[model samples]
Target: MDGRQDEVAGAMARLAEGDRDGAASVLRAALARAPDDPEILHGMACVARASGRADLAIGLAGRAIAILPAAHFHITLGCALHEQGHLEPARAALHVATLREPRDVRGHAALAAVLGAMGRGAEAEASLRAALALRPADAALLHGLAARLSGRGAHGEAEDLYRRVRDLCPEEGAAWANHGAVLFALNRHEEALAVLERADGLVPDVAETLNNLGLVRMALGHLPQAGVALARAARLAPEDARIAVNRATILAELGEDGVAERLLRGVLADPVAAGGAEGARAAFNLGTVLLARGDLAAGWRFFEARTRLLPEGRWPDIAPWDGVAPPRGRLLLHAEQGVGDALQFLRYLPYCLERARVVLELPPELQRLVGTTPDPDGLIASRCTVLRPGGSVPGDVVARCALLSLPHLLGMAEPPPFAPYLLPALSAGAGGGERRVGVCWAGNPAYRFDRRRSIPPEELAPLGEVAGVRFVSLQHGVAAGDPPFAMEAAASGDWLETARAIAGLDLVVTVDTAIAHLAGAMGRPVWLLNRFGGDWRWSAAFDRAERPCWGDAASRWYPSLDLFRQAGPDMPACAWRGPVAAVCAALSRWRDGRLAGD
Candidate 1:
């Protein structure tokens, strides 16, 4: 080879060995001698990119492209532009690279990523498909496709693709991680854990896989293990905000609010976590902890970040409508998150109805469950006019907001008053009871904070001791394991059956899970069992400390209900026992008329 070619090859070798500084020095020396060498310029760009000097890389790549107009140089420039967040320019450069070299899978894949970030899923999917066609056995291409499908809520198809990728490349850590994520989304916690564990073992230092493992462990009620995994992930990727946020979430569950707050603050201080989805998560988590600590204003500000935290294309593209609607027009309100979230935020429907003609889009499951929510003018329906996977309002609607944002829009300082809201049919043999008391010892196990919030059935045995109270299990679909406390188990066919049983009861006591939110929304007298770091909604303090522990005992915002909190995380069982005893004693006194009724 000629001397110049020999010099370029040496620089390329240094870059390949991850010695960016060495590569840069060699490239600079070659460029000084042969300042217009296309190969040397490209080599300099690669070194600059490896060293995190994206702008320098862009300039160098531009020079190389000007000299030889090579597709590879355009790909290098695209990558550098992407790093600088010049997405449109990066996309244009990637398009030129693909045009110059149609068979270049890497160029196509880079373009797919840029298109996906721009919310052009259809185009991105097409690009990914083209890349896959060129390199059918490529594990990275399969994983990327699976991720895109998963982001669009095509879980079944995504799961199939993930499994296929894993089968083909059993040792690929990213494939296993993707598989775990899909399983977790499907609520297969055990399978998720196994998959994540496999990924963790294969690539022990990958921060993303470790984070996924931590999430699964948390879901399975393994708090300490989850904490360890999350901590390790944070340590491995100190600059990654998601790892820090995940770690903080686990800490909050462990009731270490002080530590969680500090970690979240530290993450927010990093510029990378300041404006996008990561920033939103950091803000939301930080707000949640603050709200639990009773810092309302700051908590609400952070809470607002929830909208920004959604995946790039998941949120509605339409602008939020001003409260003042066009004459004779309607405002669309859509649900986000879980059923409990929909119910909790439904309290704002009445206020919204007062301002505009309201149409609410809800989960199909809750369609009949929340029939005519807020009554009269507000129309509640299962389907939207323009149904999109991630919630979206109608194009014709002047404005829209997520149901959870109603409280903020309504200018409410505190949660609206509670009343006996949803009234599903009572089950056979549910009524005619002498002060029925409903109970739910556990919650959805998939929740990351389930370990802190849910109690095992065995811990609820104390409630069976309460005199004049007919304690009945209101948990439905899921099994209620044997409780140490003596209580009668009531069989339920569905949520309606559970609701019917709860209707018969004078009160219901549950953990800070969906049931607690359901009971509260139903305007039932519900004694909510809360952990030290409870969810944002339950942080609101209420009155009426004594009541039937069931269906509408006190009228003052379920004035009939009460709140029982664990004193600390070390021994939550001990703290919970005292509240159970107190509740039992109160029920006995109320049954005896020792406490006068209003």
Candidate 2:
């Protein structure tokens, strides 16, 4: 190569190595010798872009393109325009560059970035795939495509591409963090934690990196570590609503409710955060905190913001049922969250029945069981019709309401009706043996809070020591592993079948799952294995000192239920021995009482 070209090459190399000063010095010397040279001008533009001087880079790139209209010059110009937030102009420039040199990867890659920023996701993905076809093994190309896929919620493909990127560029902290985030989305918390820990070590001060690490730690139930990482992230990006929301959630979980509430309130009050997705999350989290502290009125109001968190088109075009008046025709009450949620909120059907004809939509799992629920006045069997989710709505249906929205819509200042609302299957007969106790050690693993809410099966071993009690296993889907105690497997074909088994037991002990809700609805004696800062329904247990109770402690929501909470927020799931020991002692006391009665 000639002398001018050699100087430009050296400058480009320095710029690629992040030595912007060295690149600038080399480009300046080259410009002095050949002031009109396009390559030297382009090299200077790169240095200016790397230094974050997008305006200067735009000027230098324009000069290079004016001297000799080249594809590379247009690519530089497009990149500078994109950096300056002129997305349409940047897209036009990149389009011209790609048209000029259809084989150039940089032109296509830059066009993809501009398209992505413009929210033209499909076009951007197409451009990225075209660029990848030319440079199949490029780490940057793979990472970009992976991020696009991740944004589109194609986590399986994103995970595979991120794996390739990590293998190709193991030292890149961003690649590791991206990979970890994909794993976290896929619910592979252990792998995500390992990957995020590596990323935190490599980029300890990066707010986004620490945020991802904190989320992974939180999912693994490492509360203290999560708090530390998220605290640092919040400090680094104080104005970032997403980071603030996450940090506040961790604080709430850790019993630092005052600080958590303050952070969440600030986010809700900020104009930028108040209208965005993060703001909605902040509002929902604030509601949780308030409800946990027994501020029912404000909690329900703020909790209304959760509807904003739902994806667009989540509901049909039908008008929503306003809590104010009885629908002229049928009121559709649809379940929104988990089965446990549906079971808990089904109590509100009678309230809806009081106003209008009620159409209750539920998951198929609970259809048979819910069909068996009876009302002393025969309202349920006569007026309320059970429909499967997405089932055909009757032509007379006028408005719909989410099952969980009942309390909020009704403006309930206190806990709604709490009574035995379900009937045990007739087949369920009384047990005559040792006091039968049904036990469930875990909940649905797919749930976001399952790690914290679920107990390790081995912890149930202590219950074996409680004499005069027969333990019946109520766990479903997955094995709870062998405990020191003999647990008879209950015949649970469905929710109704489980209810049958539960009806026969003298008492039920379980995590926060559908079984707990079922047993409570049956007015069966139930002990809840509640996690610290668990679901809002269990708020009475969390703030029992301030919360009013109709029956025993923590049974305001379910008069027949009791609660066994984690000793503290920072206690890991494996350290569940404390609650298990408590249950063991309680069981022994109950046994002694029964013996004394006999």
Candidate 3:
């Protein structure tokens, strides 16, 4: 072998033994004999960078690149620059490395990383895809692309790629874990649990997989299994804000919000939980916890974090109005959630008076019913936008904020105007001596907690048998079977028709759906059936210790409403019957009171 080759081989052997000083000595000796040899210069540059002499490394790598203009020499320079946190220069060097090699995996990977560091995510994705194209069967490159896609919210395509990656690398625990996470996002909890379990067998100590397993179990209402998994994950990754938040969520759902409040507060104080997306999420979660416990100003302040949690499409760049009546600009209130949420929060829109020329936006489902909203202060003359998915927002609007954020802006400690806000034009009164009670046994199926919040229509069959009470269906969907009520065949689609029907009913019995919100706003008396893991609004209102452990029977938002919650697991599988019976018992007493008065 040549003298220079002998010295380079000796340097590599020293570096392999973790002897940086010995490696540098041998590399310098080689460079002295062949002053501009690219091989010796490349070896010297890598050794210098490893020893924390980035300036020396960069100079030697530059000399090597000038001698040969080769891929490895350029890569060595890029690594040296990256070690010094010189991202832009590193990016340039890596780009050249990729160009020189054309198909080398290391150059492409390094280029992609530098591009990502420089906030060029799309270009990084392209670079990674290029690497994958060269090594189509490579599991790591495919997995990397899948992770990037998932981060960008392209879950459907990510899921497909994750499946491919899992098949290609069955022993890779992270691949299985990520595949399970995609399944969780797609609401395929059963598949997620199965895959996560498989991952656990391969790599039992992985915190992320445990976190996902807990989440899947929680979604299925298996709280004990979820708690065990989540607690374990929290212990494993005590510094991961995501794991801590998930643990807190389990506590919150199971009516242990006090512990959740503590856990979330502790996590928020830690550096890991104090910034970035995790910080935003923790802030939003803390808002919910504090709000549930009746801390208004603090909760509302933290609730501002919701803006950060949402996608850029959902939360636009227009200056958000800070609950102040703007002196000179038109204020836009954009709907950021479902039609039901639009209905619930519409009360706040009219309050945004001559403060600004208002352009309110809401979902199409709620457009027809907007006419019925109370404008006692007299402002909503301008037509609001009926937003559809992928539709462009108007360019004329000045400041924009989400409709759900109204309560935080309004500082609403005082009770809402209890008088009817929705006095739709009266339809003909029903001809019956019996008290007509409207019933809604379901909510939109797409809602994440629909499994816990909505009851099957058939579960209300027992209530249908009540004497002197006629049950009328206010449900909207393809029923599992013929409804056990007297809903008019003509009364199924339009929100206005539904409003008119609800206005005519003597009372309404429903789950925590938008219909309940509508009926409550219209001054109709309602019995709101709540799940054990009820919503934050209901928890805030009825989570008093003075109430029965079973549940509270009153509402704060809907003054004319009564709440009935599902019994806890200790109460028998027949706990479902408790809410049904509560409504029936209340109905019977109302009938008796009417008869006695007559």
User: Best candidate, TM-score-wise?
Assistant: 2
Report each candidate's C-alpha RMSD, comma-separated, in the order given: 8.5, 4.6, 5.4
Question: Which stretch of 10 consecutive residues in model 2 shows the poorest summed lDDT?
Answer: 543-552
User: Model 1 off-target regions past 4 Å?
Assistant: 1-210, 256-259, 265-272, 310-318, 324-328, 364-396, 417-430, 445-452, 458-471, 480-501, 540-558, 570-598
Q: 87-189 in candidate 2: lDDT tens per residue?
A: 9999999999999998999999999999999999999999999999999999999999999999899999999999999989889888898999999999899
Per-residue lDDT of 304 in model 2:
78
TM-score of 2: 0.83
**Candidate 1 global lDDT:** 0.74
Put the candidates in lDDT order, highest first: 2, 3, 1
lDDT of 3 at 281: 81
Provide backbone clash counts, one per model. Answer: 9, 0, 0
lDDT of 1 by residue, 167-205 (tens): 998988887888998988876778999999999888887
Model 3 lDDT, full chain set:
0.77
109: Cα error in model 3, Å: 1.9
Task: Go through the candidates in order and give each one's C-alpha lDDT.
Answer: 0.74, 0.84, 0.77
Residue pair clashes in candidate 2: none
